[model samples]
Target: MAATESLPVTGGRRLYVQLGITLVVLVAAGGMLAAHRATLDSGTDRLAAADGEWLLLACLAAVATWVCAAVAQQGAVAERLPAGRLVAAQFAACAANHLLPAGAGATVVNLRFLTRCGLSVRRSATALAVKAAVGGVVRCVLGVALLLASPGTVRLPARVPPALLVLVPVAVAAVVLAVALSARLRRAVGRGFADVREVHRSRARACALWGGSVAFALLHAGVVVAVVHALGLGLPTGRVVMAYLVASGAAALLPTPGGLGSLDAVLALALTAAGAPGPEAVSAVLGYRLLTGWLPMAPGLLVLALLSRRSAL
Candidate 1:
């Protein structure tokens, strides 16, 4: 009886710890949101009159992107487990990402999920790294193509010129050189290439991954546009896209939790440079955060809750 009572107490203590950690993260994220919110007009009357259809579409697009992301994750882990299981693992990982400090928490959660599903830690780590690399490469390529194709749409500040174009090719060359220089990466690339060859697979998977990534990128950009539309702000689509890509790319490179403060700052600056009034741009960015960062977090938190309950049972 004492042991039974102690078990409940122990579990309760653990639950409290988890709740405390989650609350801390929420508080930190809220603080960042509040700081940005201060710069926004965020008038209740304006927010109330915002368009609904676009907001709904934005939510749909975000969900679609999440699904595509899960599919891509599954593809990367296909060799380790059934596709359905891998998809579930991906969703769980995404949920963890929302709750944890850095996005890396999602990767750790994913590795655990994969291990539970019978994959070795080493294999799971390798697969996750590959998936992340593929996703990042695809997004970067699409971002560059979009920026180049619609140069007029994506205006940089006067300080930034077309000469910045050199950075893209330079980045590509650097990556190729790095791959050649690193024996580990070279061997991995060689093995990956050989795997495709032996499986009679060409670049089909790569193409599909890139296509899906681009779709997600566009969908993410649409979220910002929808937010602006919802706020009744007449922002240019191209400018919005440019800001979204730049802010997103910078956030991806940052070590902060989900890029917290840095993303909002860059976005606000980008929008301002593109001729959006400061208050309006900040308002639009806040709305974008609500849709992209917070709304999904509710579902993610619920998923985490269910997982915890199952573990307790």
Candidate 2:
């Protein structure tokens, strides 16, 4: 009886600790964002004069990104989930994703959400792996297609640093080393792959997974494009889309909370390299971040808290 009583208390303490750490990270990220706002505000006058219609469309695209993400998440699972709850969970997960590097926070939230919806922990994890893998492959496909269509837009700089060349292989090695070190983890991965095979056997599941992932990526690009249009930056739409894909792919190679500063800087540079004016590109990136990251942050955090209180996490 005593041991059983202590279990809940211990778990509660652990939860508190996790939340506290997340809150601290959030605070730090906020500070970093504030410090970086100098670049963002460089074109505040232009930003203020942005076309409202295009800005509104960008906001809609942001909303669509979340919806598409929810669909992608749902498609990854075999069991039917409560639609409203699933979407809300994804909304909250987006906020959680920003609190940790490398999408770890969002992974945790979705893992818990999937289990709550009905699945063993292994199954839930497998579903997430499938979703991530599919999303990644689709993104790469889109990026490559765009690159081939407009090679000049995404052309590598004249000199590639030796470090940038080795980064990817090194990251792959690290992941392989981590997985190889744990027998239990290997088994989990094997099981996850098996689940992926099982889920893909269903045509509806497969289509939903691919379609939602594609839509999610496209909507994100749409947000950037809308922001550019709003700011009257006259870069080609194809180049902007290509820039977004390349920058996003590069940002994913590094683990940062919501790809905050790194993403903003890379994206803005990519836009300018593709021929957008510096101030206009900066303004567009700022608007995109506002629509996708900052504005939704507070409500998403609130939803996260609500979900946690209800044990939906």
Number of the top TM-score candidate? 2
Error at 105, model 2, angstroms: 1.7
For candidate 2, lDDT tens digit of each residue in 47-83? Answer: 7898999989999999998889988988898889888
For candidate 2, the lDDT comes to 0.85
TM-score of each: 0.73, 0.85
Error at 199, model 1, angstroms: 9.2
**Local lDDT at 185 for model 2:** 80
Candidate 1 scores a C-alpha RMSD against the true structure in Å of 5.1
- Which of the numbered candidates is closest to the native, going by highest lDDT? 2
Please give the CA lDDT of all the candidate structures.
0.68, 0.85
Q: What's the CA error at residue 285 for candidate 2, in Å?
A: 1.3
Clashes of 1: 0
